[model samples]
Target chain A: MKACKLFRAGDRPVLVDEDAALTPLCSGDEREDRQFGKGLHKEIAALQEMLYAEHQRKVLLVLQGVDCAGKDGTVHQLFRKINPMGLRPVRFDVPTVAETARDFLWRVHLQVPRKGEIAVFNRSHYEDVLHPIVYDRIDGPEAGCRYAQIRDFERTLAESGTTIVKVFLHISKDEQRRRLQDRIDDPEKHWKFDPEDLKHREKWSEYHAAYEKAIAETDAAHAPWYIVPADSKPHRDIAVAALLAETMRGMSLAFPAGDPKLAKLRVK
Target chain B: MKACKLFRAGDRPVLVDEDAALTPLCSGDEREDRQFGKGLHKEIAALQEMLYAEHQRKVLLVLQGVDCAGKDGTVHQLFRKINPMGLRPVRFDVPTVAETARDFLWRVHLQVPRKGEIAVFNRSHYEDVLHPIVYDRIDGPEAGCRYAQIRDFERTLAESGTTIVKVFLHISKDEQRRRLQDRIDDPEKHWKFDPEDLKHREKWSEYHAAYEKAIAETDAAHAPWYIVPADSKPHRDIAVAALLAETMRGMSLAFPAGDPKLAKLRVK
Candidate 1:
């Protein structure tokens, strides 16, 4: 459970399972869980203040999940109480003409939070690998290299004062079907409903496999991946928030003393 | 003093005075000031955590002063209690051949803190402007253009989510003489006694004029300059820490929320 010490890169089959949902923080009662989550939000907010006061490191939340698995929804729920000035929510859609001109990480590096900041990426550089591998635009060998590159990139970020928390929202296929059907049933949601979602749904299993491969290859202590049981929306938010709060607390953040000698000095 | 609202760029004469040492945070009691500094350090660290959690903006502490002005010591004392994991102390020295080949800011931009990281420059790009002008490597009109370029660079950084805190550690000429004499008297500290220090001391007035010009040209609402009274070291540290703590608090950092619907979910 202490991921900073135990997380290591593992093979795809060992690291990610297609049919598993781990609801670690679930209380089995929606109301109780909601109450606990509210408290956690307050605690998270306090921890965030310490992180800002310390202003020496960064935290990045990487949210990657299948469409309608609630990536965008998770971001909205987790950050509603937090001050908007400090949180930058970057939703990486398709690569733009300029973004594709360079390495995928060029744009990613540009978006990474500086010290005393937190950045949540709705979809991230992981998409490049996931899409290419799923669509067969990249071969297994090339995909393997990309994974290695990602691992190195992540480690570099971690080593350079970034606490990276990557969460993979795990939703059941049935949940996805319901979510997609609900989107179609409501006219107000039509704008968010892309026809491409249905086409991409056809290759869900392939995308899942691609995810497993990439996550397994890149998983490491510096940047740990969490597989949240997102089949239940309440469970997903609480679990992820709990994980973040715990990770932040472990950092041992404190206010810096400037001139401890000046600790008792009378300035004139 | 609401700095953000009132910090307008002024002319060199009004903004910077070579002979004045401003002890802005002084309360006239050393013990009381020290106690307050201790409390402020704790507050500053807490604010740092919030900044990191909010992770939307960056804070840059650009420390500039004459030689023997306690830049290194200031960085050490200010960050003594901070989590080293979140802080990056980047000392910018003479440019290397590769760095000189590129534009001046190319190397500087590379060292700028990413979102959520505090980058403390012991001496900074400001050195390029100061030394060159004093040494006459660049004439008045050229120096003026350099100042314009610096203004543009700082503005771009500010507009792009960087909160810059520039500190000019103001010390007396007599203090430099005493510090240099102490260094020479102690053979044990010979390694730190650079012959170049004496040469730079001879150009003290020119260096002060250069700093005054550069600061005046670059100070703005988004990136304000603090003139700290380094003649009184304790006052200097306490004032700077207080300023930084106040600046960070103004950022209003907090943890973010996502998907309000997930707030009341019952998980099993």
Candidate 2:
């Protein structure tokens, strides 16, 4: 099955129905599957080079997941073969003092991929909806307004020749607990360990509910969302690569045909 | 001699006195020099990773040169081994309608590197001063104002824990003519060929004078300018890498110390 269809969150997606451990695209042999994932990444890189040379369209990949759901790992894996010149990976942290002064989407709009570029957002404007809704900072009506604003914003980008791919890295509560425990156990990774993560984990159900609501309300044909099971890192990497490669392939990008008049021009 | 001292644009820089073809840092062997350049890039990549892990200070590299001076090539070579997650390479083109509406520095300010990030500008705010002066769009008084504004702007960034390294990729007029001609001759490179390059070539002396004025006025200890000889691509790569590596080494970046309180805490 095509990854787009295989992982697509249909009209109504229940968080409980998706199995985070399922690896439908994997060939069952771990080594072979890893190689397959690498191959897909190479393909994505080649396609990106063409898109850059074509210099016409833009590609934006949004990765959203609970902590330790492998958003960073997935990005590292996906772009291993790609040239940094053509890639823009943006990690949106908490809003700065200046950012809070402006509209929520203002900073985001500033970072959208320019023509002939591929931009990956580690966490994105989606955080605006997810965090506020989970923390009860914004009321339901305000949340609805933000969702409409996001839909309009994304539609504007799609209209301007940007292909948007939004992926939700789904991991089970058990998987999250194990990953959190590993971070706590390792001294080197203690820098990445935040006490606030425990507080957030306590509200896992609420956050999941928030994610479901955000995905359901804002998912559109132009900016499709994929719920990739991310319990296993390699599986998550493979799934994200397949989905992205498939997406870029659909763009049908090619290098520009040169001017015939320049064919005979020689360097002095 | 240290690259910092060797390429430093002194108090009174005469562009004519600088030899763009000089390879003072090279070992007089082509292959060895290329390998040495690669080694410096790796060292830079490692330093950048530490800087990202430190998550405190910021680094900004600004490249300014006439057309076909290999700005893009410098960036590509400098970042081949560095992770894109820690790198932000911004290419500033002509301002759009929205950008034109604001003060020149407004758009440039928005793209400054975030904490723990290294941002490289292929062409930068210097263009704001250089282009206008060369074209007579901004008069001497206005140019002086912009130059002072640039100095103040860079000082602000430096005070806020951003180490700025500005480099001029100095290529001879003959070298640029050959590069421009090569772009015109190769159909594959036709997409990069802009006819305006020939128009700009006619005003080479004006552009050089503008650059000299801008550098002399804005150069500071906080945001020092390096006049790198760039007639040979390998020489340019080596000088940039060495200067940047030296700058970062002075930062003393390292992984954050693990929290003592988390020593006994378990994830469960």
Candidate 3:
């Protein structure tokens, strides 16, 4: 199935059920599936080079997922073959005092990808909608204002030459439990485990609802959201790669044609 | 020769000359030299992972060179095996109106590497001093004041856990002429060529004088300058990689030790 259609969160409010994340989207062979994923990654690298050479447009990939939904892993997998020169991966942690003092979009706006660049946000302004609502810090009207602001922000990015692709890595609660357990069990992986994750896990359903509302309200043709099944790490990588390759293919990216007069210009 | 000592710009005024740029600093075989360079690049990649995990200090690599001096090429080579998540390659162009309105270091200070990040500045605030002084826009006393300001700026970063490594890619005028000609001859590379490079070439002596003066004034124990000979691309890459690997080795970066109490905690 084409991931674009299968994973596209259209007008309907997208729901995350336990069984959906466990669905095997790839051919069952893990090794072959990883090879296929690598091919898609190579395609992304090629397209990104063209995007850099074209030097007229930009791409922003927003990876939003709950704790242990594989946002960081997906980014590492996607960029294994990509050049760091043009790829910017920004991880948004809790905002500082200065960030809170300004409008919510202030810091996010400062990091939009420049022309001929691709920027990936590990988590994004969507946090302002998700966390605050889950904690009862902001109510319905405040959320309505934020959703509208986000739509406007993304529209500005789109209107100005940036192609926006936002992905939600959908993982089942059971898978998250296994991942969290694995982190706690491995001494070396302890750094990845945060005690706060458990608190967030307790309110999974609330977070899911917030995600659904945010996606439904902010989704647009200019800035579409892809809901990728991410219970299986390999499947998550492949789906994101397929979605990005297809998005870039539609951009018609190419190297700029050289000026004809430059053929005769001497350097010395 | 230890690359640190060989390339170090010491107290005596460092001059750029054709003979110095042509000096052979590597093993004779080009293939063998590149293999060695790759090993150094890999070392940098490995050290960078630890640096990222350490998450306390930052590294800023400032690359200043004349037109066609391989600043961009060096960055690409150095990061071929490095993770993009922790690497930020910032290319500073002619400042926009907003940038010019502020203090010269305002935009630069904003782009300094954050904790755990390795930011490579393709061209840097040094341009603020070099270009202005070369064009007679800033007189001798003003240049001196700006130099002191830069030293103060760099000292603040150093004191606050930034390891600064400034490199000057010293290329001969003859080598630059050949590289510029090659760019003009290759249709695929025409996009990289700028007409204004020729205007800078005409005033190479003036630019060199400005560089010499700037380096002399800003050179500090914490923020030292390394003059890497760059007539041969492979030698230049090898020198830069070696310099970086050694610098990171001195940093004593390691993964943070996980909390001992967390070892007994079970994930549910």
Model 2: per-residue Cα lDDT at residue A42: 88
> Cα deviation in Å at residue B248, candidate 3?
1.0
Stretches off by above 4 angstroms in model 1 are: A1-268, B1-10, B13-24, B258-268
Please write out the lDDT profile of model 3 over residues B157-237, one tens digit for every residue: 999999999999999888998999888888877888899999999998999888888888888889999898999888899
- TM-score per candidate: 0.52, 0.88, 0.92
Native-referenced DockQ of model 3: 0.52
Descending-TM-score candidate ranking: 3, 2, 1
**Candidate closest to the true structure, highest DockQ:** 3
- Candidate 2, after superposition: displacement of residue A12 in Å? 3.9
Candidate 1's TM-score on the B chain: 0.89
Residue-level lDDT for B205 in candidate 2? 90
- Model 1 TM-score (2 dp): 0.52
User: Candidate 2, which CAPRI tier?
Assistant: acceptable
User: Model 3: per-residue lDDT, tens digit, A151-170?
Assistant: 99999999999999999999
Which ranges in model 3 have alpha carbons more than 4 Å from their true place?
Answer: A13-38, B13-35
| Candidate 2 chain B lowest-lDDT run of ten | B9-18
lDDT of 2 by residue, B142-235 (tens): 9989988998899999999999999999999899888988887777778888878888989989988888888899889999999999998988
